[model samples]
Target chain A: MAEGQFCNKSTVNTEEGIRHLLSDTNGKTYYKEMEALEVDSAAIQATFSKTLKSRLKTWLEICTHCGLCADSCFYYLANEKAPNQVPSYKIQSTLGELVKRKGKVDAKFMMDAMDTAWSKCTCCNRCSQYCPFGIDMGIMFGYLRGILYSQGFVPWEMKIGAGMHRVYQAQMDITSEDWVDTVEWMEEETEEEYLGLKIPIDKENADIIYTVNAREPKHYPEDIAEAAALFHITGEDWTVPSVGWEETSIAMFAGDWEACKIQVESVYDAMERLKPKRMVVTECGHAYRATVTEGPYWAGLKDGKTPVESIHYVEWVAEVLRNGKLKLDPTKKIKEPVTYQDSCNYIRNAGLSNDARYIMSMIAEDFREMKPSKEHNFCCGGGGGLNGIGRYRKQRDAGLAVKHKQIMDTGAKLVISPCHNCWDAIRDLEEVYEDGIRWSFLKPILLKMAIIPEHMIPKDE
Target chain B: MLYDYVTGPIALISLVIFFVGITARVVLYIRGLDWRLDRVTYTVNVKYGIKGALRSLFFWMMPYGTRSWRVKPIVTFFVFALHIGVLFTPIFLSAHNIILKEKFNFSFFTIPDALADILTIIVIVSAVVLLIRRLVLPEVRNITDFKDYMMIAITIAPFLTGFLAYHQAGDSQFWTIVHIISGEIMLVAIPFTKLSHFVMFFCTRVQIGMDYGIKRGGMKKGYSGQNW
Candidate 1:
């Protein structure tokens, strides 16, 4: 077993990262945008105040503080089982602050509490699973963040996520033109491999609507290329909506509940308009978890029933593999030690962690387990809009010791984290804590292993 | 003999307090249920079907006189013993039991000599342990409201009186009178007091579960699970 004593690093390199995160005039304009959109600030405040009572009541009532909750917390486990890192303490600190002030605390308290609540605890809900009394601190924090967002006390970086959601109803802030251009670019790149394959956009009566995370278009176009290649090889009937295809809803992360509800609703509306048989979320844990699980009802999708079916990318990939649509040359992708980091939103929330591992095994020859895998996976310490807030670097790095050690223990040079936030958060952890573990999406690895028959090299030479 | 137990003032006060307490609790429970169920938003997930809802409801009913096999039998019995003894002892028996017998010729079940004595001891001991647990455990301590202590005190009074009256120990009848008055006070206090948690728990759980289940894919098969 790996070991480490608890260390609290409070010194934030504020000047370095905080400059990038300062909310500009454009950011402040979101309040106006919301007002223009008829969002009632006073109504929202009242709703938040009401929510605070239930949230506080739940906080005060549910926990029996058995401390068994601490044993399974990745943060606590990493910190030599320190009492402070215990999952309950995070809730206790904020709830105590709220009670002490009777919800009349100043903005400074909001900033401090939001950072501690959001940056420190990933919304993995792993502690909820392990708690003897089933206290859902993650959900509680989600509400706390929501209340904070209503008050406009949101940290700078998280505002971007909500801004993206407000602007495009997506996470990555990829504009409509950018999405079309990215798809066209990827389609061109993949056509060289598929001869004359086309990635359809807004095609009516398609069997499925393939949605991609904003990261694929915003930063990692190759990830989208792999998705195109897989679909091209499979000959599956899929379409990407030019209007509403960006899948990740950072509004959900920013604790902008109304914004999140709208974003989720837009996806449903797109699905209904296209009348697709199903919706396939490309390699995003939170996107899939929210769309298929939490977001639908929150958006009032329960009047009748949800329109289109939804499945995670792992499930789709496994289906494609089973159907003999994709062939793989595992040897090409098997060079170094490889391990899978289960995304919490997918593993615990969506139950796709094993499906991801099963997919990983097909491509990586050196696939190994990260001890406590699947539903029990640790958070990457970058959830709940932590990465969005540049002010949280110190706590993010220091609090993520559990995930850092888990990655280190696997001794794997390559770690495949399927979710975009995990990739960002884990990569940030590597840089800040100097715990180097090469991280990439599983899609890229699968691309290296995948072989289209037409592109296959001849055996005779 | 009848006059020996309940004089005019005890009967009048006991009946009035008991009626008012029961009415208030029922009203609060109904109102709280309406408000909680009418809530527009909920976050928890409940997957079990109507079968599950009934299971949860019926299981909770065990301490209220309905029993179920699925819940923890021993724990349920202990809890049931505590609840029933608290509810029935002063209001229905011992003090009020004596008052009705002496004044109105209305008698409920008299606790048998053996069971009564055994249960009286258990009730007092369990109340002390529960109070100590509330005080000692940090999690429990953190959430404990002031009303919780009062409820515990109200619950334990009858058992304490029964203990004193068992041996006719030291003006035991006067102590029994004190127990009857306190029990009546609790009934009047129950609806307005946090003791309504007794009824609120089921409604809230059901509401939370339904909200969660409908949000999760279990409610709608082909609907896009997206939250909007």
Candidate 2:
């Protein structure tokens, strides 16, 4: 009902007399079903009563309408600072109102809530840091999204993303055999350079169980290759399970709670089966968040922990560097004015800020810190699955302007982003800004700078 | 007759409801917290939970402690001043202390009457600025429902009436009665309405601090090399 609130101006808000527009870019089948889906108010009310817990109920009751969370959100700051863009307004107009009305919301109201849930806010949780009452709008939005998903009003990719995790146990459609082939393929390509390099599969009692983002195998197998080589040179024993190898949960992003449980249990299942000493996730932010931080709770693990110890890719790299297990060639260090993207998932959510800085200090000669670094760094605008939503591309780019300015202000030619979401956002941001900025995942930079032991180096060479 | 009933019984009832209602709200939320989902706390380094909560509470209490508070120092000043005046003036005012001394045979320390007057004036000025900000600022105005405007009015009523009654600007007896009634109403509203934030702020800080502490590896005991 507010201005600049809908994802698209033509987006139909009510199932009754709703306009049907073809969606070509976002997931085709899901978007069509969503468009045609009935707006069942009774179902929405039933779902609300079922899900409303004490924490959210109390939070909803306590908000003072201070409008303080406005500047804390990039969506509010970057979108010309509209009133509706404010975090409080976004949640209040949608979920807050839904609660106040006891979920007597109409089809149009649900549509408006859907718009705010997905498009207006990326659920970055930055606002939670600044909220005087600690009203985590991100967490509230996560709950709101569950309501939306139950009523079949979720975004295109989200529905499909949840489906992917449910059907494939991975966010992508890659089968178990395909994942193994990709891991082996990467090892084959990289094994020539480093002796004793192996992509072990389902190796029980290994020291490490390495889980990777499904995106790595589908789009960038080189990341797997680089990880294998680094592990080989460090003399670390790690195995990738055929099943439960995909660590990223788009279901988590989609707010499909049941699917989130299914997805995270897959990884936890791997940990219980293989009995690794620890699990090390790849350089994907949400993957680390889903499997390690939030996944434990979803799977009902004790004290919010995985079965074995779990570490981020950055943490493992930083630890190896510190312990002298991984050595970097001084000559290959990043020489230009370089900046590190403080990824939201691990750095802010998981407290891996020091480890990322350690890696930056180790590898970069001219490392420049963003103005607000560490836990306070702004979101990369693509978090909360903003990168893949085709319908909200313009809004996503507008939000990118906030991070774009943060990056450009450092005047760094090269930006090292350790998380896949941040890296992807940078890549997309660079496409538009074209500031001659080079973006990288931490794996590539580490692989480039890491020194291979002479003994581990090929004897023929 | 109305004054006798209002001051004698209604005031006592208001106090009972205010304290009992707020306690029940806090206890219910804490009790209802699903150990599986909401109450996420650290395992090894539980000290970080206390430390983080204290840090968040301390930083948020100061005028320019958080960046959000620092963004608009002018608003922060009004908000901080308003809160200080609202919290302390009711406790330390001579008239209220005198009433407490008469009823309970005890009284807390009292501020100089001049200082209380100044604090009351600060509260009114801050309330007006906040109200104006809500009306004029488009970002604020959109979220400004009738209930928000009512909350502001309810918050300022006792202070405004007390200031008028103290100065004998109007019918002094009437204004005093209004002040007493308004103050009682405000207290009763706290546990029932959004005004509950006064006490809920501490509860939320405790919950959120643990959330951040456990996630951030505040004490470096985190499973990940979250030595950050």
Candidate 3:
């Protein structure tokens, strides 16, 4: 089991213990799938042809192996400084070896490569922030995943999620009808609290086409209601489309460019049909990044211009607050000291750190900053679709040790994370570390603090 | 006669290789420019990108931008000092300028002999510190390969020989010839080894800042307090 080999007893579960838990489960299928894949040089070269570029080449060539990036990785810190967990080592062993071998490798090497690329590294890009060379390891790992994905070697969870997106147009496989019903249900639920609240659906030419993660509909319907309530009070013209409504992209995480293209194309098509001036994505980090940053290129847009402007909901809300569209009641602030967990995509990828912090300061009465907040903040160990992969639960949990210590040092009662994956990972950490800290999305906190005008209040209320 | 050949023909060949090889690499990178259209969907703010690129170039020149400074402040200081020393010594040192004046018929700048000596000492001492760290630190040592050590030796040779020649410590003429030869070797090796980072560092940083800083909205006027 190698108990306490990688991490302290408090944070790390024994490998043997994890194996025991997975003995009867489908976790064993992942390794079997890796072993079963028919990998060859041609396929490997084809993958590289699709993924490789000058930037990646420069990164591979210029990395000095300064080891500065080691401290930036949560897995490295959590795993008692395992050298293999170092970001450069991960790239060196997998991509480095592949390049060294000229794309000729055996199945055992592929197995090791897959584990290193998919399981160990989360593609969070925190190391890039620390890298003196400015090498984005996250993008590098994404390319590695793309190569592995071409070989049909991916975690089962990712495969299922990508399939669900292809078939059902949502990561959770929620049907269009179910999506509509869920929004309608959320409207009804919110109506009970604030009368005359409506979740406008399929409205054309709206100022904003608001989209949400499939998890909002399938699991956390309250988040939908919370967002709806905020929009209702703020008097913003927003609508949710039934088709292409789910913004999360499992295809992007799985590195299936075709599937990723389909997911993004659907959303862009929806936006084009609805003719929204802008699209506001809910608190899903990867979804927002995939749509706003990477979607245009995936869709083959020449100039990197989308049909419609896109903004993360955090940025949208902050803009709305700055524009005086909605007033926040200082008296209704959260009494407990709170800290914000900067999502890697939102902060590092999108530069929304200040916007999120600006919103939090307006809402939280006592806001304490994490020691290393914003772009430098450690990943919550759930990025790169690792949260969805059930086979790596123990590894992901142990990886939370670095984040756990960061949160504990803040001495805050509540941690507000703006991204779905960050929220889920932090919640898992709460359970794993038994840290009695509560977690909430920024939407709920915003809804709690926004002062509703008397005229906007329901007549019944 | 051997010293003259090493200082004249070999040195000239090394310079030719250095410039030609570096120019080729740069040309290749230019041809391979990744429009980065995948990650940036809007009209790139070139003005902001250039500004951010310049800012990042200067920011990382010091040790303040990374957290490793906190863990190994001494190493950080030495590394930073070494960079400063190596970059300035060749360009501004009076001895190098005398040679430049004779060969190229022009000299742009010259530092005092004492200052040049001090900078040379900084380079030599920092090289030692870096080498020791590479050997001692498991994290650093694991990544350290033969080429890494070779590059370090190649880099140190010129500075060490130059310092010895300047001081006329032992066989001053012999040391001077060794310094010129070693310096020539380094010039030839720069574009071929990890030393290429010396030329590509700014290009890479500029791309990073342009993509991340301008496109991703981190391009604030000053250090945005984000790690970058």
The best candidate in terms of lDDT: 2
Q: Sort by lDDT, best first.
A: 2, 3, 1
> What is the per-residue lDDT of model 3 for residues A156-175, given as tens digits with 9 covering 90 to 100?
66765666677677787588
Error of 2 at B14 (Å): 1.6
Q: In what order do the candidates fall by TM-score, top score first?
A: 2, 3, 1
lDDT tens per residue, model 1, A160-200: 56656765666655678888999999988877666657889
* Pairs with backbone N, CA or C atoms under 3 Å apart (clashes), candidate 2: none
Winning model by DockQ: 2
Q: What DockQ was computed for model 3?
A: 0.47
For each candidate, the alpha-carbon lDDT, in order, equals 0.62, 0.82, 0.79
Residue B75, candidate 1: alpha-carbon lDDT: 40
Model 3, position A214: C-alpha lDDT score? 92
Which TM-score value belongs to model 2?
0.93
Return the TM-score for each candidate structure: 0.71, 0.93, 0.92
| Model 3, span B89-196: residue lDDT tens | 888988778878998899968999899889989998998988888788777788767888888888989999998998899799999988998999899999999899
DockQ of 2: 0.48
lDDT of 2 by residue, A1-461 (tens): 22112122122323221212223344465444444455656766777666677778877877777887888899998989988799888898899888788767665677678878888877778888777888899989988988887776777677667777887888777889999999999889988888768899999999999999999899999989999988998889999999999889888877788888988899889989999999999988889888888888898776667899999898899889999999999889888999999888887788878888888999999999987788778999899988988878888998899889999899897988988899999999989899988988888788788888887788763
Residues B145-194, candidate 2: write the lDDT tens digits.
Answer: 78788788889999999999999987998998898899999989988888
